[model samples]
Target: DAGVTQSPTHLIKTRGQQVTLRCSPKSGHDTVSWYQQALGQGPQFIFQYYEEEERQRGNFPDRFSGHQFPNYSSELNVNALLLGDSALYLCASSLGLAGDSYNEQFFGPGTRLTVL
Candidate 1:
């Protein structure tokens, strides 16, 4: 009965450091997607996982990666983080392909990361 959940509500790190954020999907949901939102910009898609495999991705670089566990939980990892990477990382889940308006993705509050 819970909605999507994310860990480490906020984080702070220096340039070049790596960070991993986590998420747990709502009950009965399977697909998980990640997005990055800058201070004043809309979220940019990171990637998505379904059945433990990455099903879709965005324009992000290879440094952005993720994993989905059997329980429908997921993790988002950023390597060699850059100052520009400082933003709110959001996790979303849906029962089916998120494109369908009927099955719109439910989002989490997001993990805020600050890069110095």
Candidate 2:
């Protein structure tokens, strides 16, 4: 089965410019979660999508949003991005949401976004 995959492995954007990154979940997975990993820090959950609807979210502001397609692929959209948004954006997939034993997530290499 194909594993999770992310596009643009790397990106560069200026402060205040919006960016959209894509993700394709692993085969047979239905849940997709977006995470932001700043240098030296652990991945922080941005939000999660299941069955094409956002099932759970984190402490992120309105500037951060996402969408999951019927195919189980997803996209992370950041609006009015800031310098702080520059980080490695990771996409993870699981059979279900957190707390479920079946939810052991698989992560992609991530898109390294650089905000200038």
Candidate 3:
């Protein structure tokens, strides 16, 4: 069973450019969620996708968007990125919304984005 995986491990970008981050969910999971963690801050939920559709969204601006494909993999996109967007982007996966605690989500190693 494969665990969640993220790309590049690290990334560097300018303030006005765009970036794309990738993720693959854990085995036997059908949902994916993205999070942004600033240094010394807890992760802020960006959004979640299930059944190939976005199910819930957080307070992030329109610049943050994502997509989930049929295979349960996902990609997060940030447009017109800002310096504040520099943070550790984490990808989490969970099973469907069953009473199972398995729905509690497991995180990826994260993609660290540095915006200068």
Candidate 4:
């Protein structure tokens, strides 16, 4: 089975522009988490979704939002983009809730977003 996949491997946007990145989870996975990775920095958690609801969120501002569908696909939407928003946006899929220690997350190749 295919692992997690993200659309538009790369994206370019200007400040104040909006972008939406898509992700399809691995087979049988039900939860999806989004992260942002800056140059030379580890991925920073953005938010997590399970059962079609956002279960947790990191330090990102309100400009970042997301949604999970019944089929386990997800979309990360960023509004009023800024230069600081330029980063590799990652999508990870797991089998259970965020608190489940036994659940391992499989990450996608990531969508690289560049803000000018």
How well does each candidate superpose onto the true structure, as a TM-score?
A: 0.94, 0.94, 0.95, 0.96
lDDT of 1: 0.93
Please report, as a residue range, the 10-residue window in candidate 1 with the lowest summed lDDT: 96-105
Q: Which tens-of-lDDT digit does each residue in 9-37 have in candidate 4?
A: 99999999999999999999999999999
Look at candidate 2 and tell me the lDDT of residue 107.
99
Candidate 2, residues 41-95, lDDT tens digits: the string is 9999999999999988999999999999999999999999899999999999989
Which is the better candidate, 1 or 2, if ranked by TM-score?
Answer: 2
Against the reference, the lDDT scores of all candidates come to 0.93, 0.94, 0.95, 0.96
Per-candidate count of clashing residue pairs (backbone under 3 Å): 0, 0, 0, 0
Q: Given candidate 3, what's the lDDT at residue 95?
A: 91
Write one digit per residue (lDDT tens) for candidate 3, span 1-116.
Answer: 77999997999999899999999999988999999999999999999999999999999999999999999999999999999999999999999876746558999999999999
For candidate 2, the lDDT comes to 0.94
Candidate 2 collision pairs: none
Show model 4 residue runs off by greater than 4 Å: 98-100
* Candidate no. 1 TM-score: 0.94
Ranking by TM-score: 4, 3, 2, 1
